[model samples]
Target: MADLVDSFTPSDPSDKSPFTFLNRLPTKRLDAKITRAAESGIPQQGAQTGGYTPSYLYLSHVPLFPLYSDRQHELLAKEDKHKQLMIKAMNDADPDKKLTGGQKAFLGTIGHLVGAGSIVSTQRWERRLVGSNVMSADSRMKQDKLLIFTRWTVPAPPGRQRQGPLWFVDVLEQRYDESSTSSLKSLSGNATMLKVGVADGRKVTLQLLKTEAKGIKTQKMWSKGTKTDTCEAMTFVGDNEIVAMEIVARIERTASMVEAMEVRKRFDKEWLVPMVQ
Candidate 1:
């Protein structure tokens, strides 16, 4: 069994497909294992058995930086602002106007700062999530880079039809181009798109429409109206549209941080280091 599993491993070191070991098993042997498990009242793991396991793209090996001090202070200020706004809204409510029970309850909650605090708390968690899992550096001295961690189906080996979809965590470098606004405007007027440059020189667009947050769309350059591929970077329960917009904001913030860090490094090299020398 060990030898059979080893045979399924991809020859390429970079091909970290998790299903390679199980999918490479011989048909008869694989069937027998499944049958034995069924006889023992245990289900086999795979699409065939209806057992699904999620794969995560971990950044444990990457060095992560603490949230920038400026950003931390900004979040704190925003939270305070939210609290003040909520309190003002409640106090400014028209006394002559009759309010529905739901409206009154909402006003009461907001007035107490519960609703406002929760909103700000969620924002803080989202920012921390990005800092912990998405923004990373190759080394302590390196500028932080934004990464999109997603699960993608591995392509079938050459000439062999895939028995089932095999998923593996894929790490993609997300590049932001501010100058591409004119080009993006040509795509769609209503939807906001993030044009990410992949490490392989391919352009991947993440479309966050005002109406929906379906998935990330990837297409080759200059291929307008062509069939594009879609993938999800992160999964969320309930309304994904809100989460998608938040992700776009987080990505932009991270990109800005990276840019700022680079600028500071250049300034240090040109002025501070030279003065010291």
Candidate 2:
């Protein structure tokens, strides 16, 4: 999938954040337009000889505890039923249930195994997932003029169908045309993957991925120091891609051995999973 965003190369390679962190962020006030962010990325001016301002995208990471999907809920229910069955079997004291002394010893071993496995605990939250500030901070700190680029992490819950977190995900596709003073949902679908291309060109082949921004909410926030309006959105980071990959690994470790096992099994199956197992 075309990564919706190209990860940023830090101005200071030592800093792990995918953005350039200035000792003091520049105070120049520029509207969220491609013409303004040119100090960092490509210059949109003049290049549009007979043309106009280009587009910009804002993407940054935020720690999240994703809500369990419906399928995951079903799995938990099945596992719970089996657990009750196992508990009853372990404690049965009838003559048939009352095992010989040897059977009693075996039951003790089974109990220990159950205790060890019970740590496969998982957690969930209202689809709010993580705080909005944490989600947008990096992006707000990165580009001068920002245009948020997002991918739906998941559909919004029914009650919040309109003007809610889900609505922000839809905004990702609404490209703003400064000249027209309007916006439109672009059909140039493949625009997300281009290394570089003329956007107006038709037949764009776009690459896509499931960015962990399932229930994103973007809004105007006051930058207390500057007190200017800002845009923010949620983003995902998987392990093995950046130095922060270590963090994703650690979150899984504390969450569950099973979760860690599952992570290794799926992502680094040949290497880390076997070592842990």
Error of 1 at 100 (Å): 18
lDDT of each: 0.29, 0.23
User: How large an RMSD does model 2 have?
Assistant: 28.6
Q: Which pairs of residues clash in candidate 2, taking residues 3 or more apart in a chain or in different chains?
A: 153-213, 153-214, 154-214, 190-206
Question: What is candidate 2's lDDT per residue for 162-184, written digit by digit as tens?
Answer: 22221111111111223321222
State which candidate has the highest TM-score.
Answer: 1
Determine which window of 10 residues in candidate 2 has minimal summed lDDT: 119-128
TM-score of each: 0.19, 0.18
Q: Where does model 1 exceed 4 Å of error? A: 1-60, 64-73, 96-148, 151-277
